[model samples]
Target: MSPRPPRRLPLGTATSIGAAVLAFTAITVAGLGSFGAFSGLTSARLAMLAAPEAVEVEATLARVGITAETLAAAGCSSGDATNVGADALAHLDTTNWNALVSADGDVRDAQAEVDRLGKLVRAGQADQEDLTAYATAKSTLATETSTRDGLLDALYDAAVADLTSGETTLLETMHGNSDRPVPLQYTVSDRTDAQWTSLRNALANIKTSGMCGEDPDTACTTLVTNCNAETEVATAASNLDSNLAGVTSALHTALGQE
Candidate 1:
């Protein structure tokens, strides 16, 4: 047989092949476009997923900042004498207290920045720059918050220690002079029943008074009042001891024993 002409595709076959190749090209382009869109969507979803954590962190920092500030302020009031007295030994001042102030301001500023970035992230508008800035601010706020808390605790502890020592000293002084007799202008039996009853009631009230709770301002006020009362009690006891010593001295002189 004569050399067979190269087997050729039919016209229909050629047309069909061309159409199949075009369809494949279109499908591939469409698939690539879909994949790009899916990738963008996934990135956006990841950012949204991270936003709640940012919000929570910011809130926690804010709470800690407020608590530290409140405690520090409570520990150092200008109006409360006990707070002032305790802080005198602790030497707490605006300089030390201002550490919390600075930290609080920093944390608030950082929280605001994080909130802004978190909103952008949730809206799929955040870029890498926003994410980086948010992370940096969060880290800085954490460090500052920790430092602020430490300072607050230290100052509070110092104040407590000073106040406790002062209270103890007053108690010891009162106890030491408890046996001393109060000087009387007349015989005990000559005193009015009402006067004795009032004295007993005053002592009972002082003994039964309760310390303030929860409210820092109230606590400070209570502490001051109690401390003053304790001081007065101690002073009264000391005066009774002095008076008894004077009486003993006068009696010894009268008897010519000295």
Candidate 2:
């Protein structure tokens, strides 16, 4: 018959062993013991330390409102759809075109009415007062139409200026041509790679040991094996904390915080 499986430890003993494993792992990886406050940390306690940095990074990114996915589709390097203000130009153009059509229609109707009234006056069929009234209405419509055209022109000019400004800003930002902040995509990718690498290194360096003496009893061997499994848990927690720190650093760089 096969040998009997090692009996599992009591729940309390198992909990203690798991805690010990994680505490030691944190000490080994973060060297937090030297930091005084972290000298007595529990499992993954250092993870919370990245929170304030994360908040600060998010605050800095709030100004642009750009995301990694947006940057990808925007083709910042190729200048495709990068001018965020260009859409306003199309909207202004459509509005100006509609206004011009409506104004032209109004002027044409008024002119036709004035011509009809003038003919009637010439034939002595209508009073000069009616002809004068229609002519004055046409002149008023023409003046209003001119004013509308001027306003539309001004709006179009403003929209073009905005588009130009946005393009300039994008170009400068992408090229790091000035003090303008770098785009999020360009800065975050490398930092993300570095973060994963750091986590991998941390996990690789996770050393495990068992306090077993020669002629150790079955219980001691079983306890050591189970506690060794806790290294996986500890590394997972470390990975989470590392991820938080990495993201915070990436966002800081994107914000030009460094």
Give me the candidate number with maximum TM-score: 1
Q: Candidate 2, overall lDDT?
A: 0.39
Query: Considering summed lDDT, which 10 consecutive residues are worst modelled in model 2?
Result: 1-10
Task: Tell how far residue 104 is off in model 1, in angstroms.
Answer: 1.9
Question: Which stretch of 10 consecutive residues in model 1 shows the poorest summed lDDT?
Answer: 1-10
Error of 1 at 110 (Å): 1.5
Report clash pairs, candidate 1.
none
Per-residue error (Å), model 1, residue 253: 44
* Tens-digit per-residue lDDT, 1-258, candidate 2: 122111222344335434544454565556655677656765444432322222222321122222223223223321222222232233334344345334534655666777787778778887767877867877876775565545434433332243344433432242231112322223222224444454334333332222332354455455434433554334333433434344334434443344
Alpha-carbon deviation at 136 in model 1, angstroms: 1.4
Model 2: per-residue Cα lDDT at residue 214: 33
| Per-residue lDDT over 169-208 for candidate 1, one digit per residue giving the tens place of the 0 to 100 score | 3322322222233222111122245544544454344445
Per-model tally of clashing residue pairs: 0, 0
Q: Distance from true position, residue 251, model 1, in Å?
A: 44
